[model samples]
Structure formats: structure tokens, C-alpha cells
Target: MWGKSTAAVFLGMPLSVLVVGFAALLSHDQASTTLPWLLLFFLVWIAVMTCTFLFRTGLRAWLWMGGLTIAGYAALHFLKASGLVRIAA
Candidate 1:
């Protein structure tokens, strides 16, 4: 099960990378470039998740997943504050 899940992640990360690459090429904007960076981040995440599956317990996996979530939220917050995105009242 662990092997299967890890392989799934390894395979899936490249698809995400491709999607982001296509997106970056399809759009001509600063935001588009940054969008690919987000994909790269996720690729790293998938790799981490796959690797952490080897642990006896899933503590590191949980921590890394939680940390990624927080980091994503923080990125959104900063992007909104910087006027890259608008927050609706």
C-alpha cells in the first residue's frame, strides 16, 4: 500500500508540473509565472509525502502536510496584501 501510494505521488507530480508549465506558457502575465512556482512547490510536497510514507508512523507526514497548508495560506495572504489578488468584502 505504501509503495503504491508513493509511486502514485511520484507519477502524479510530473502531471502537475506539466499543467503548470502549460499554464505559464498560455498566459502572459507576472501571475502566470508565479503560478508555476506554486506547482513546483506542490511537486516538492508530493515528493516529500512519498518519502515520508516509509516512516514507521505517519507523524512526519502529518506535520509536513500541515506545514504546507499553513504556507499556502500565508502565500495567499501576502499575495492579496500585495494587490496580486483582491479580497472581496
Candidate 2:
């Protein structure tokens, strides 16, 4: 239990940030879209934390979450490089 909680704090939290950051990068930049995306961010965070306990070991959880975080950021970078997504200056 403590291990899972620790993983949630150390690994899952960063994973959720990467997830939310990727989502925001893909979302429309209008101010009207901000609230919904913020809500989605919280939901994604909770879901990631909840899923952290599914792994049999804390190490496995860390590995999976780290992989996801890397994948999310990589996809975002790819999209930006490919001109599929753009950020305002």
C-alpha cells in the first residue's frame, strides 16, 4: 500500500503532468476551451493515480508510468515538428 502510494506520488504525478501537457498541446488555444481542459486534466490525474496500484510492484508501476510520460512528450514533440500542432508565441 505504501509502495503504491509512493509510486503515485513520485511517478504517477509526473506522468499525469505529461499527459495533461500533451493534451493541452493538442487542444484548441481558445480561452473558451480552457475550463474543459482543466477539468480533463484533473480527471486524467486521478485516473493515473488510481491505475498506479494495478501493477504488482512499485518498480513496474514506475517503469510503466515513465514510459507513458516519455511517450506522451514524444508524441507532442512529433506533432509540433510535423506542423500538426502549433503554439502561440
Candidate 3:
């Protein structure tokens, strides 16, 4: 539980950001949409944390979360390079 809790606290935050980023990118990416994601971020973070505990072990949680974050960043870069979305970063 300690490992899982740590993973959830540490990894889950970035995963939630990536998820929100993905949503924002796929959406209209305007000021009007900002509030919705701001509201939804905590929900997504909580969901990711909850889902982490469903993994078989702490290592799995960390591995999967890390892998997912990497994949998410890759996808973000791909989208940016592909010129599909205009990312400030």
C-alpha cells in the first residue's frame, strides 16, 4: 500500500496533467474550454489514483504509469510535430 500510495501521489499527478492536456489538445483549445478542464482535472487525478490501486502490485502501478506518461508525451510531441495542434510549449 505504501508503494501504491506513493505512486498514486507522484505519478498520478502527471498522468492527470497528460490526460487533461490530451483533452485540451483534442478540443477547441480556447479560453471557453479552460474552465471545464480546470474543473475536471481533480476528477481525473482522483480517477487515476484510484485506478492505480487496481494494479496487481506497486511496481506495476509505477511501471504502467511511467509508461503511460512517456507514451502521452510522445503522442503530444507527435501531435505538435504533425502540426495538428498548436502547443505553446
Candidate 4:
């Protein structure tokens, strides 16, 4: 119970953030399209939370989640820096 909650906080949240950030970046050109993207991200968050239980151990879950979140952020950063994706102000 506590472990699942911990995973939701430390893993699920960041994973959702990464997904939302990428979606936002991809849809930056069409700001009005954000609503659907946000909806999709919410579904993704639910899926991520459910999937966390598949790991055999809490530590493994945290490690993989943290690592993937970091990698996703890094990729987003690279894409933005390279101007492959433009963020609207």
C-alpha cells in the first residue's frame, strides 16, 4: 500500500510530467490543441501507475522510473535545443 503510494509520488508523477512535457512540446505550434493532449496525458498517467506494480521490487520500480524520466527529459531538452521542436511563448 505504502509502496504503491510512494511509487505514485516518485515515479508516476514524473513519468506523467515527462509525457505531458513531450506532448506540449510537440503541439506547441497549435496551442488550442492542448486540451486533447492533456487528456491523453491523464490516461497515460493512469497507465503508468498501474504498470508500476509489474516490477518485482519497489527499488527496481523506482530505479527504472527515475532513469526513464531522466532520459525522457534529456531527449526533450535535446530536441528543444536543436530547434527540432519549438515551444510557444
- Quick one: best TM-score, which candidate? 3
lDDT of 2 by residue, 1-89 (tens): 77778878877767877766666666677356656766788788889899999999987877888788788778877887999877754
Query: Alpha-carbon error at 76 in model 2, in Å?
Result: 1.4
Per lDDT, the best of the predicted structures is 3
lDDT of 3: 0.88
lDDT of 3 at 66: 91
**Model 3, 1-89: lDDT tens per residue?**
88799999999999999998888767765566766987899999999999999998899999999999999999899988999888443
TM-score of each: 0.37, 0.74, 0.88, 0.79
Per-model tally of clashing residue pairs:
0, 0, 0, 0
lDDT agreement with native, every candidate: 0.53, 0.77, 0.88, 0.81
lDDT of 1: 0.53
RMSD, each candidate, Å?
A: 7.7, 2.3, 2.1, 2.2
If the candidates were sorted by their TM-score against the true structure, best first, what order would they fall in?
Answer: 3, 4, 2, 1
Off by over 4 Å in 2: 28-30
Name the runs in model 3 displaced over 4 angstroms.
87-89
Question: Model 4: per-residue lDDT, tens digit, 1-89?
Answer: 56666886778978997888777767646577776777788788888998888888887888888889889989988997888887675
lDDT of 2 at 49: 94
What TM-score number comes out for model 2? 0.74
